[model samples]
Target chain A: MKKGRLERFLESDVDNILYWVSIFVVVLTAIIYVAQIWFVNYTGRYDLLECRLKTMTGINCPGCGGTRALKSLFKGDIFSSLYYNAFATYGAIIYILFFVTQTLERITKGKIKGIKFKMVYLWIAIGVLVIQYLLKFIIPGYKI
Target chain B: MDNNFNEEPNYTGEVVGEPKESGKAKASMICGIIGVVLCVIGCFCCIGYAGVPLAIIAIVMAMMSKNETDGELTQQAKIGLICGIAALLVLVLGFVIGFVIGFASAFTGA
Candidate 1:
């Protein structure tokens, strides 16, 4: 039986799927970031992304302040980004560097070394995320 | 009969057991399932970007499972790959829809 297009695509090689999707996701993210910057510049409003949890519970979620952190990071305000969300600020930087190296390695056909993903990376994120979330509760004065 | 049962019946030391799956395949499957769960939660909740890292991890792990062959993947690896892709798609959709709606509303001075 002849396979349909969707079936064929779904059954395609894992590497090819990952490779293409990674590129697409990264590029889409970059475009969205650029558009966000433009929007902020044009509108003079940072109300685009509201913390739904804060609005409902009058408290911060684990990911609270992420949007502001991203905004600051995109604007190159590292200190402010860290103030908003320390882990997010550094995570974005690391992710960008990782992707850049990955692209270079691919383009250069492995001539350039790429950053390898490690389980420690996930562990670090988890630790930082939890600690920061805890700090937000323990120290009311902390900006987090 | 007891001695025959106890003594090795000229048994070659070949271990007769189920083949162990690769570490990468197992990791991929674990990460993929977690990624899907997180991504789904993220889509419905405020933490819409939560599962992006897990999805990437799943993808990387699945890719690493490839042996000498470029395209070949085990069953677990395939599950991981599919789930990772699905998670990514779901995350992107949630984020993009949110941004688009927000952008449209703000642009209309609403």
Candidate 2:
């Protein structure tokens, strides 16, 4: 009798590896989350590379200080990240939500629903990209 | 249009292939192409770090296209995804390692 695909997959050592890898990712994300919270609470500052770099370089990238924004966001400092870059904060939230939902579904062997990539959303993203690039280049006060 | 009553209808053995590819798949291929283009631009531009993540996403999406019924679209997506990932990784690593070294220099005066 031919073994079913599920039975074969379950029997494979790849399943065991995948299980451990997933655990590692979850634990690492959790640890990073905690560290981010601690850092934000202790420092009372959302950024480590903010004005210092901005001062040196006369230009800013659209994603300037986005890493710090991500850390602040993970620390539940929504307002802080928003202050840094509202779009980046929103993007991070969206990315995290999608990642978590899909990861959970995959782990549970649940069917993941397809997200319709709307034209509006794409246009919005493109607009944000252009605006951010312009702010970085044209508006010196908005650097970082 | 001819209407026949009670005559044994001849079955044409010609198998019409799958219906033309869905719009969704075509859109994904477009997105994958865009991702590759953005990643390449990011490599030359200062935003090399962002390229890696975007490229990775593109590669995953392209690979996911394997389940799609369209062969040509799948092939294009795969190529774009691979190129994007490779270029992005090289640029990101270069910058990341450079930053690490720069940071270490701040700690140890040499």
Could you tell me which 10 consecutive residues in candidate 2 chain A have the lowest summed lDDT? A13-22
TM-score of each: 0.53, 0.47
lDDT of 1: 0.68
lDDT of 1 by residue, A25-108 (tens): 556655766786688779986654455445435777666777689889999999898778776776677767767887888799
What DockQ does each prediction reach against the true complex? 0.11, 0.09
Question: What's the TM for model 2?
Answer: 0.47
Residue A42, candidate 1: alpha-carbon lDDT? 94
TM-score on B-chain, cand. 1: 0.73
RMSD of 2: 9.2
State the weakest 10-residue window (summed lDDT) of model 2 chain B: B41-50
DockQ of candidate 2 (2 decimals): 0.09
